[model samples]
Target: MNTRELETVWAPRMLSVLRIVTALIFLAHGSQKLLGFPASDGMPDPFTMGWIAGVLELFGGALLVAGLFTRPVAFVLSGQMAVAYFIAHLPQSFFPALNGGDAAILYCFVFLYLVFAGPGPWSVDATRRQRSA
Candidate 1:
């Protein structure tokens, strides 16, 4: 196919892939903190910032993966990532690399993009729109 055609055909599919993969990775962070499944040092204490972040990451990531309520969920998750970077990483160093917050920064922008992008064409949101129209 031509370049334009390829882009047209694959762009939405790629967006869904991006959403799923990113959510899977983000979910792992929550699992580590909450369930200790990948076995971090230990689970965070209940209702602490770390534990709260884990809760959001776990549930928000799941919602994002399904593309359910994608825009609002992405907004909240994006905000969470931003707060995580500032609170956890910025104090350590000015540079994201040095602070180990590069992933947080990336996730922040990506989720923000999803907020604007409307979960592409492979989401429950998309299906709902299609049905309602």
Candidate 2:
């Protein structure tokens, strides 16, 4: 394939890959917190802000994994990441590395990007849109 054509075909696929991988990782975070499948700091008590955030991560991460309601869900996820960084990370140090906030920072920006870009090919949203047209 020519360079431009290759780029055209690959770009959307890259987005789908990124969305899927990121969602899975985020879901693991949720699972660790809520389900206690993986080791983590600790599970929050029910109805606490931490518990609520874990709930959001589980459901929202699932939606992102499915590429359903990509924009809105990603937007909310992005906001959650931002809040998490500021509240949990920013207090510890000036740099993300010092504060152990790199994941939060990365997730915040990645989800923010997804909010603007929408789900790419291989997504349920894209399939639904295609079917409607």
Candidate 3:
């Protein structure tokens, strides 16, 4: 196939994969907060920070997975990670492996990337565009 045709065909597929992967990661984090799957000591209850994190992760991740308002969702998630890093991780140290700092930094960057790149051509937004055209 020609380069243009290949781009049209594969680009969306690649984006779909990235979206799914990122969504799953977010979902897992939400689940941890909501369900206490990993049994974290910080699981918040009744207007606690953990509860807020759970809600954001669950809803944001769902929206991202569906490719609905992905940029906004990713932007929010990125902010969440930024807060987490500064409040919880950075005071400990800058090294991710030293504490949870690394993970928080990584998540922040991933969310930022999603915010800029968006859900790509395979998303619900893309479908909406197709229908409108």
Local distance difference test scores for all models? 0.93, 0.93, 0.83
Runs in model 2 deviating more than 4 A are: none
Candidate 3 local distance difference test against the native: 0.83
Which ranges of candidate 1 are over 4 A from the true structure? Answer: none
User: How many pairs of residues collide in each model?
Assistant: 0, 0, 1
Stretches off by above 4 angstroms in model 3 are 1-8, 38-42
lDDT of 2 at 114: 98
- Give lDDT: candidate 1, residue 43: 92
Candidate 1 residue lDDT tens string, 42-109 = 99899999999999999999998999999999999999999999999999999998999999999999
Model 2 lDDT tens row, 81-131: 999999999999989989999999999999999999888998999999999
Q: Over the stretch 13-126, how does candidate 3's per-residue lDDT look in tens digits?
A: 887788878887887888788877766665778578778989898888888888999888888889998999888887887677886777678778888888887788878978
TM-score of 1: 0.96
Preferred candidate (lDDT higher): 1 or 3:
1
Q: With candidate 2 superimposed using the best TM-score fit, by how many Å does residue 61's alpha carbon deviate from the native?
A: 0.7
